[model samples]
Target: MIKLKELSRLYNINKTIVEYGLIELLPRQHRPFSYTLMRIVLFWVRTKHQHLSLPERLRLSLQSLGPIYIKLGQMLSTRRDLLPPIYADQLAYLQDNVPPFCGELAIKQIESSLGKTIDELFENFDATALASASIAQVHTATLREDNREVVIKVIRPEIEKTIQADIQLMKWLAQLMQRFLKDSERLRPVEVVYEYEKTIIDELDLMREGANAIQLRRNFLGSKLLYVPEIYSDYCTKNVLVMERIYGIPVSDIDALEAQGTDLKLLAERGVETFFTQVFRDSFFHADMHPGNVFVSYDHPEDPLWIGIDCGIVGTLNNEDKRYLAENFLAFFNRDYRQVAQLHIDSGWVPEDTPLEEFEFAIRAVCEPIFEKPLSEISFAAVLINLFNTARRYNMKVQPQLVLLQKTLLYIEGLGRQLYPQLDLWDTAKPFLEDWMKEQVSPTNLLKKLQQKAPFWLEKLPDLPELVYHNLASGKSLQKQQKQLIVSITKQQQKNSKSYFYIGIAATLTLVSTLAYLQTDKNLAMIAGIPGLFAWFLAWRHTNNE
Candidate 1:
């Protein structure tokens, strides 16, 4: 049963979409008659933002809708494989900023989660929110034990119900798009919505976020390029998180960084390096590197350090994903479009039957112009977008696992551009990838792998002789079974041959009887017919017996 509230909400969503002229963004040829009729019926809900571009309109519409939609837009912004560069660019501007919930309520929730009052946990706890986002708000406090400054993150009150309601509506709309819209399969509305749902729901669990932060902090411990805030797990819960508060210039604050004499070029290059290190070296990366979650340290303006927070979302690549990615990147660096296409095929990212020549040609066409200019002038993200767009024509589906990586790459590229436009991404990444690739196949790596397995091998040494004996006994038994099976098959073949011989004889007798019947002599016909009947009976009996 549909509630009145839900129905009203659905109508409002439709009204907002219509007023934003989102339907007009669709091609005229693709629009169904029913869509035209609906627009005609809702003629009074004219587009209010006629001056804005389609992409701008979309961003604004999602922003106006609410935090869930804003988060959806943010997630979609990373999907260059699914959307155009322009729309994705606009969506990247969608902020997660939302008004904070009540501080009193947050305190109560925290006390309930930790089973203690605010005073027992900390000193100088601020009731006012230090920062607020869609999922949670942060409150600054000093730990009672060591007087360490920390931020208490609490999930929004009743956010689950809001998320569920909005997600259900979004799912319903996605289904409508899947059913009614042309070429909607390429967009994959339902899958995108489901992905957004999972991301948002995961963000609701602050414990997972805290754990992710801890893992990331461990990975970057004593490192120069990036720093993750320490998670205070003792005071954390599913709905609340406590972590060391970091003081750094916001990565987006270019003016402040410049005022502080930050090495912008090195900073930009280091950003790319850090991203690759997380992906290839660590295999676990902070997927959300949006400006809000990233900060620049003040201590070293010459060699700036990055402070990462809000590790609710992270991406991991297995050995295969890392290998293929490194190879593909190196191939791109070398302008080897054929290798790129072949890698995609080998990785099963594209169809096996895809023509190598045609794919290579498509890639070269899309990538050749990119190399015409200096490498520093090129956009790695743009190159990826073109490659993905071309691959889509060849029926390449979007890789869901790579969505976070792709999004992070975009964030990195944007940061690079903002920090230092001439930072050559290729130059920074090529040697790293080449060196990593070499390390993967080196003798040292082989030794390391063997050493990793040494303990397991030693544990199984006592069983080796028993395993060998069992294997030999099983082989002998298998051979005996094979010989017996061959004998059985031979007996069946002989029986078939005997039955066939009887059938041939019966056929010959029947033919002779027909010939005799056609003759004028009745005694000859009678003698032949009796023999034919006896032969037929013998054949039937023999066949049935076999």
Candidate 2:
């Protein structure tokens, strides 16, 4: 029932559309009732009617729904193919910003989490937030002796309860959808909820995010590909995290980046290379590559370096997925749409019964025109969306793990476009994946396997002779045991036969003796017959027991 309210409330969302002037911008304008219906509903609760632009209404709606719906709006905004241009344009303006709880409340949260006063824990802490988001906010600080600048992040105390309540409502909606909605299973809404649950819950743990940052930092430790900030483990807790503060311009400031003399083209290409390195080489990547979370270093402005933040939503792929994905991308580059379609079926992304030839043609129809143009003109995210839609017709399944990877790719490409319009993503990323594939299947992997197996082989080496000898000894022992058991059963059967024969003989002798003594006593005949009958009954009883 609560689930119904949660879904119903979104449709009845007040204020946002009216405030932003989106009452006139409902999607189906060709149908005349669209605008009037939306306007009536949107203006329901306004004391003073206010006019807002299309984008403004979107931002207001996102803010009104709070974090969960804001996140959904953020995701939907990325889907350029799925949404109309006007709506997409407006949705792009949606922001995650919220009024932070309070400076004192944040202080209390940090102190309680660390079990120490702010001064004892840090030499200095800025009361004002450097940045704030849905679940947490960051504050700039410094150590007592080293005097190095660092950022401390703390989770809002009641944020978990709020998120949990929203999640429960989402789950309830998904369950209802499965029971009553057509094509709900096709979307796998329940599984999607569970995946969202895992992702958001994982983000609540600051230490886990700290470890994530550290591991991603290690992956590119000495490289210029991407820089993940160092995590200060000593200061990390479930609710609090302190990490190195970096200085770089936000990627959104194109004019500022240009003023710094950054080579926008090379920077765009490098971004693509960094993405490939993380996915193919490291198999772990910073999943949240949204524009707000990324920054460009001016130190080497001509050859700009990327500073990545927010390690909360990283993605990983298993070995099989990595291989198939690499192969699929390579095939797409070669314009072998047939190979691409086959790879999907072979990897179990599509059902086995999907006709290979038809699927291949469908893929070619969708991708051929896109790749015919330059890479910059090609949107990798759009291509993927098309493929997924086509595959859906053929009963394809979404690999939940790949969702983060896809999201990151879209962000990387979007950022790249903002930096340089001529960025060729396919050209930049192909070489790296090809090189990594060769290394994965190289002789070095075989040698590494042998090295790993050395200890087990050595342990068995000393017992080789004893094992062989035991096997030979046991072979004859089993045959001999079987023969002895068979012989014993045969002897038992012969004993039964001998006992019957003896009984028959005794009965015949008793009868003969009775005939010879018949003249002496008539009673002797009856006694002889009785002995015969007794022997026969005894023999019959013995046979029955057997």
Candidate 3:
């Protein structure tokens, strides 16, 4: 059953799709009969954006739908495997450029979340939003305790309900696609929607975002490559987050960056270095690296520092993934297509039965052309995209775990090239990967691992002798029990043999008695019968005695 509100929302969504001319974007042959009926039913909702390209209109329809749809578009942009390059390229321009909600409402929500009045919590609080995004908006304030400038982020009122409703609709639509589309399995529409749902839902919890920001800030505390803003924990809540305010030039402002004499080349290289360091050294990275969330610190123009904001979304890699990924990158750098193919099999990214030679040839075919140009002209993201596409033909499933990593890599590479066109990503990353690989097997790393486990080892050291003694005693006890069991079995077998012998004698006597009776010999019969009875009693007594 559908509520009136949801039905109304759906109708509006359909209207937007029609107005943006999204249905025409699909092939005429592919469009379902229902689509034509929809056009007739909603005849008033004609196509309004005839001037825009199909991709552009598609992007506009999603944006007009709301925050959830806009976020969906942003996520889909990273999925180059599923969408064409033109659609993906247009969707990449999707931004969280939502209109700000009421400032009074934001203040009330913050006060309600913090359980205090706005004046009681802070001084010089600004009602106007510092920034407005899809999930939340930021407001500037001065903390009463420390007099430090900070930004307070508040979740929009009833945003979660809207997100949940939209997600439900998305899931329903995904099911329709899976049921009707010929090759929907390849698209994995349901799984993609579920992924987007989780990501958007996670962004709703401001406390998780605060923790992520804190961890990231600590990881890059003294680093020149990146700077994470300090989160004010005491004032933070699930719906409201307070963090130190930062005034840095947005990374997209190329003119401003150049005007400030910022070292663009070093800045670009540092971006690559920062990504590798987070992925390899720390195993944690800011997954959302769009220009809106990235900025340049004004303090260091000669040695630029990146200021990261909106740490609501982050990606982490375990040791296994990190190691395999490092090896894969190194293999790609060396043009070792065989090793690359082997790593995919070893990592269980592809089926073990996938022919090694065929996979290697396919990868080489797609990737070899990428290296023909100078290293500076090559695109790391392009190489990865080609590799993934080639692997898909061998029945390789998409790795949901690596989705964020792939998206982040695309963002970093694009940002790097935008800052410095001739950036040699391979040259910048190869040495770092080599050093990291060396560190994995180094004696120092071994010592470090030992140190990490020393406390546990020490805690159990006192119990070792007692545990050894108990184990030996239990073993001897078990052996003794085994011997006793063997003797008992032997005795039981002897008793059974004696019982069988008596029973055989009893049977012979009974047969003799019967033969005598048949011969009409009373005396002989009586004698035999009495003996048979005695033999039967003896056998019974023997069996009972054991």
> Pick by TM-score: which candidate is best?
1
lDDT for 443 in candidate 2 is 100
Per-residue lDDT of 47 in model 3: 84
State the lDDT of candidate 3 residue by residue for 1-546, as single tens digits. Answer: 445667767888878877887877678899988777878879987787899889989887887777777766766665554578799777766644556899999999999999999999999999988777778889998999879999999998988987888888877778888889754665567887888788778989999999999999999999999999999899999999999999999886789999999999999999999999999999999998877688999987999999999988888999999999999999999999999999999998888998999999999999889899999988776787777778778867667678889889888877787688888989999999999999999999999999999999999999999999999999999999999999999998899898898899999989999999999988888998998999899899989994
Order of candidate numbers by lDDT, starting with the best: 3, 1, 2
Quote the lDDT for 195 in model 3: 84
RMSD of each: 4.3, 11.0, 8.1
Best by lDDT: 3
lDDT of 3: 0.86
Look at candidate 3 and give me any clashing residue pairs.
none
- Higher lDDT: candidate 1 or 2? 1
The total of clashing pairs for model 3 equals: 0
